[model samples]
Target chain A: MNVGLLDADVYGPSIPHLFGIKQKPDIADNNKINPILKAGVNLMSMGFLIDEGRPVIWRGPMLSKALFQMTYGVNWCFNDRELDILIIDTPPGTGDIHLTLATKYLIDGVIFVTTPQLLAVKDTIKSIEMFSELGIPIIGIVENMSYFLESTGLKKDVFGKNKTKLAELECLARIPLMESIAQAEYIDNSIFSLKDCFSELAFAVKTFIEN
Target chain B: MNVGLLDADVYGPSIPHLFGIKQKPDIADNNKINPILKAGVNLMSMGFLIDEGRPVIWRGPMLSKALFQMTYGVNWCFNDRELDILIIDTPPGTGDIHLTLATKYLIDGVIFVTTPQLLAVKDTIKSIEMFSELGIPIIGIVENMSYFLESTGLKKDVFGKNKTKLAELECLARIPLMESIAQAEYIDNSIFSLKDCFSELAFAVKTFIEN
Candidate 1:
């Protein structure tokens, strides 16, 4: 499947590091930018436009404009063929970026990811609720860092058992506390190791979309 | 000194819990809401306004409005006496909240608190840069969780050593990793233990302001 990834996390874009892509996307004559192709996936991020150390010191209007341009101005299609899926990674918060996306595009659904801590869970619920109010479908929640292993070989609930029960929504995936995932610099390669975990997530997403 | 803590992180307000306050702030007949006084420090947070489980689910305009109200509409003074200092704890990002605060107030300066991780330091720099552009003074960075003690009594940099070197900015405080700071729900009493650390921070602020 052809997938396009748009890193809308303007403050700290990680797509470049994850894919290990050094070069930025190509800009066309028509002002529509071409997304960089990496491992069969088309990727675009603000990391391409700005330097590594420089911050995008923009207010609400500029942020909204940047997000809008990233979504619409960037060509996601492959040789006139439309993209199968376009995944956008936004900064954590219900702000201008979300508002622009919600108002500008026909978003399919939103999947909330939260660490199994109450602090993180509370924030995730607020985000989910915001998306729901925007008339978007709630995909489900993915609980990360759910458990850790002790020297005795027994699993321990580090952030406590995530009893995340959203009415009418299911818990899509429970990604275990993998030290490898935390320690790794690149998520693209690290994600491959958690085959079963991602497989379950994929299945859950499919079910949610199909239903 | 009289200090007012504004929990501008509307999405996930932690000031109430950190202060262990149960009662909500009082609202006067003039529509000015009073901030809850705790341990001689007046505190205000969205945590007190809304139900614990219910989400705010607000858009950009609403979010901005709420933030503006929290800063302006709230009665942060005693008997018409102005507050000596007001410290705003914002969520991690450069979004509507930051913009609203920067534009609305003549902020003396900003102190950035970041973990020793490169990922976090990079983001903190971006935030500082943004604040500088907004004409707010960059009041140095506080490196939290800088290091931890090992079983063998060696100090190990878990998140890697923080190497922040801006030409004009200084590293204010290298807060050593303390489990007590992380685990404590109420920060009011807990802050008394870190008198030295905060004392240094206060001195830094004074120096930055004088210069």
Candidate 2:
């Protein structure tokens, strides 16, 4: 799949680390930058623009501009053909980054990631509500760190119950906390490693996209 | 102490839930919003402004305004005397909300809350970097959900090592996951309930502030 990922998380961009990219993207035509290609996906992040250890202490106005620049400023298309999918890694909250993206782009839907903790779940519900209010479609919810498996193979709900109205409201994927999954080694310049850790998740995502 | 709390987390204001305030704050003279007094501490939150179950779907600009209104627009003083201290409950991340507060206010210092997990620690590092760059002093770091205590009074580091250099960098307080702490009850508008959950934390904060 011709996938593209934009790390809209200007403050703490982790896409570069996730993709293991150190070199910056090249400047394409019209001062637009080309995204770094890894495996079968094109990735871009603000992490490439600034030095590591420097904080992006920008106010609201500045952040909005940067977010706009990152989205509309870059050259994300190729030869008049757009990417099959563009996944934006946004910071947690139901504010600026979300509102900006939802308003400025044609988002198909949004997937919410949350731990099973009540505090995290409560905030996520607010986030879901915000997205719905913005008229965005609820893609699904993924419960991360849902449970841990013991040596006896007994599944333990570490964070707490996945008892949320989210499952009733939409499709919910409960991703357990596995040591192997958490400690997955990324193969050199390959997406296979991610698939190993998220085989079930990838399958679910594929089903969602296909249907 | 004449303390004040502002729930700058407009999207999911949990101060109301945490403090268990059901009624709204009253509007004082010159359109200054009077904070709801609770156990000697004055509190204000967006949760008090809006109805339950509704989301604050505001853009960056609107959020800046709301944050400004919540901080400067409100009367955070008693009998013409300014509050001794005003604690702002910010959402996670170094995004618009953090930037807005950091830029607008002469914040003395910032306290970071994080789990011992690498993911949470990574984000907290970014937040710390942001605060440092903004010239906000690092008060200290509070490690929440640090451990799970067994029935036999054994403490297990479920998420693993408190591996961050935060202690070497700043004062660090590790808060254990205790049933008594979590299940602390809010009694008759008394903030003492929270003291049960955060007595050590409160003492650490007080020491940091005094120093």
Candidate 3:
């Protein structure tokens, strides 16, 4: 399956290093390899893409058009791989870019991700509602940065205390936050920082497609 | 009350050319003028903002900052005139500027204006949740352009046959679309157009703070 990985930021920051990894598999292949194709956003640079720590800032309409061009406009990834699964990582909030996709595309489903808190849930709910209004089925929600497992055998939800109750409202799969998630800065070749954070996501994506 | 009227797409050919009108206005003696405070969002001029429309075009953080400046930044006419009310015309959907005020300012209440039909009401509900979750009190919901009254004296819901049924979910009000509203646009001023279409809104804002 030809999977199109979208860099949903207004500006594209996740594509070049990803492509570099593909070019030099032996040198770049590591746990941080997301194994997804990176489609760039507007007003982007290749240097920033390879740096891995750059932040992208953007707003709507442009974002929508960027994603649209990436999805339908470009020839993305692999040799004649049937475009079966399209994974889109959305920019935070219910803005025009997301709305453009919601109104324009025939998306199969969306996976709403958020931190486990009333505020984060509020953002997720608004996003889910946008998708729902557009007739996009929400497969499920993901609660990111959920809890920290301590070496002393104690766990704590750093963002909030009422994550379970919040999860009940959105049926969110709780993903534990780990120091391992932010340590990729030391590895110059790593494309992404988090691996354990995404193993659950990969499982979810697999389960969602299967079920 | 000194109030600044703001809308992203504040004009089109639909706006009239009244004698007293120009592209922008500071104040009208009659308190009946509709200023193009939030100026052109025309396709070519999306990101372009003049000195006046600064608060509208800059997306994300700039949009938020501009909105705050517009709210508290601009010297409102009614500020010292026993400013009992401040009315802000927000853009549709949950984006940067909208969320900024909904979460930052001490907004009195929000009355989400939506069209009739299950689909329209769904968006209204999401908007309601956005404001509600931000600790902003939702005054109620207004179902604008709900039904079209035909010349044959028959009323029909253009969006759905039973949209009112869908609108009955919460504190909702149903308003039928009227043709006289169209006729009033011929008055050569967008302000008059507003007065024609939303006379009740004028009165509502006046009374909501008075007593």
Candidate 4:
């Protein structure tokens, strides 16, 4: 059965609730994840989530095993009958975990996450290089928490909007960021409902995975 | 609270069960864990047990996060009772996970797991160097599953027939493997007649953590 191996760290906000199953005792304590998904979709959140307070000092093997357990140990149910997708929420790094995930798992594609800032773009570029060497499909990049819109309705590109520049470095299908996903609620739940939608990105991921 | 992290991984087939805990799961499930000891003697199991089948592609961030969740998360009951000790099951290499455990956590001592086998010895040397670089105090290495003895009084050092040579590479406390370990019933329950008797190694670890 095809499955998704999600990675959750302190770097990002809680995953928006998806549907089908209720929250288990393992995740009951967290105020982050959403309650349930719609009828068809089911999400199984795995691995330790870093809270805002404590410092997380993890290296590699630990990270790799947890993900493996999440796949092998956790009871995962994929909606698609012939599902074969395992999308991992990898941290921004060319470190050990990233290397192992790319090399070990015959991953169909990678949806790299980053911000619109220069540093994030720079790191994402490095990420592309590392994965490219491993011959992993560079599906696209998700530019999260892009820019801040002041109360005065004036939008400032705090991180210097550089989506186009990033997509140039890699053949990215979609560059979703501040303008599209500036809100927190939408992201935490993986909701996609914008007038000028990034359906293109989501579709790209869907087509890439399904193909 | 004086608490020490014990490497739960150092399980011997002959050693009697200590503190009423099984060394490993009898019938292995996907989530195979080398039992965790509660507060008093927090012995953490180190190293991965591979099944003859699928590949064991551990040693990454997922692995590291699992260790953190196991160490810091979970019901790791420890209070400020003054420092006692924390010994981790270190992999036999300068792998990233080992390095993080050495540098990130409050590790007082380390016990290397090695076999008489040339391969194990080679990897153990690398492990020592990695630990040394992190500046963590290594109590000593323990030659594991060292030799095999038959009921007919025949002794074989099949694993590491060449002894002392491995010890010279890194001074260690040798633990010979007992043939009785082959008894499946004893192993399934792990109720060994002669429980863990590594007094010298225990003494070294205790001295390091308490001091």
lDDT (0 to 1) per candidate: 0.74, 0.72, 0.49, 0.47
Provide the DockQ value for model 4.
0.05
- Model 4 over residues B79-189: C-alpha lDDT tens digits? 324433444543334445665677678765666777665534544555566566668777676776555444444554545355436545444455654423322222333
User: Which digits, one per residue and each the tens of the lDDT, describe model 1 over residues A171-198?
Assistant: 7878875545644556556678788888
Q: Tell me which residue pairs clash in candidate 2.
A: none
How well is each residue in A55-93 modelled by candidate 4, as lDDT tens digits? 233455465665565555543442224435545565455
The two-chain DockQ for each candidate, comma-separated, is 0.37, 0.38, 0.02, 0.05
Ranking by lDDT: 1, 2, 3, 4
Location of the lowest summed lDDT over 10 successive residues in candidate 4 chain A? A10-19
> Model 1 residue A131 lDDT?
83
Candidate with better lDDT, 1 vs 2? 1
Local accuracy of candidate 3 as per-residue lDDT tens digits, A1-211: 4555655543333344334332321112222222333333221222233333222222444556666655555444333455566666655555555666677777777887776654455445555655666678777777775655554445655456554354344443566654443222222433244455566666766776788
Cα lDDT tens digits for candidate 2, A1-211 = 6788889887777776666677988888789878888866878899889886466766556767887878777788843558888888787776667877778878887888877666566778888888888798777777877775665566766666644554345535566665554433333433443454467666766777788
Q: What CAPRI class is candidate 2?
A: acceptable
Q: Which is the winner by lDDT between candidate 3 and candidate 4?
A: 3
Q: What is the TM-score of chain B in candidate 4?
A: 0.62
DockQ of 1: 0.37
Show pairs that collide, candidate 1: none
Q: How close is candidate 4 to the true structure, as a TM-score?
A: 0.41
For every model shown, what is its TM-score relative to the native structure?
Answer: 0.83, 0.83, 0.44, 0.41
Stronger candidate by DockQ (1 vs 4)? 1
Badly placed stretches (over 4 Å) of model 1 are A79-81, A147-158, A163-169, A176-180, A188-191, B50-52, B57-64, B79-82, B145-158, B163-169, B173-211
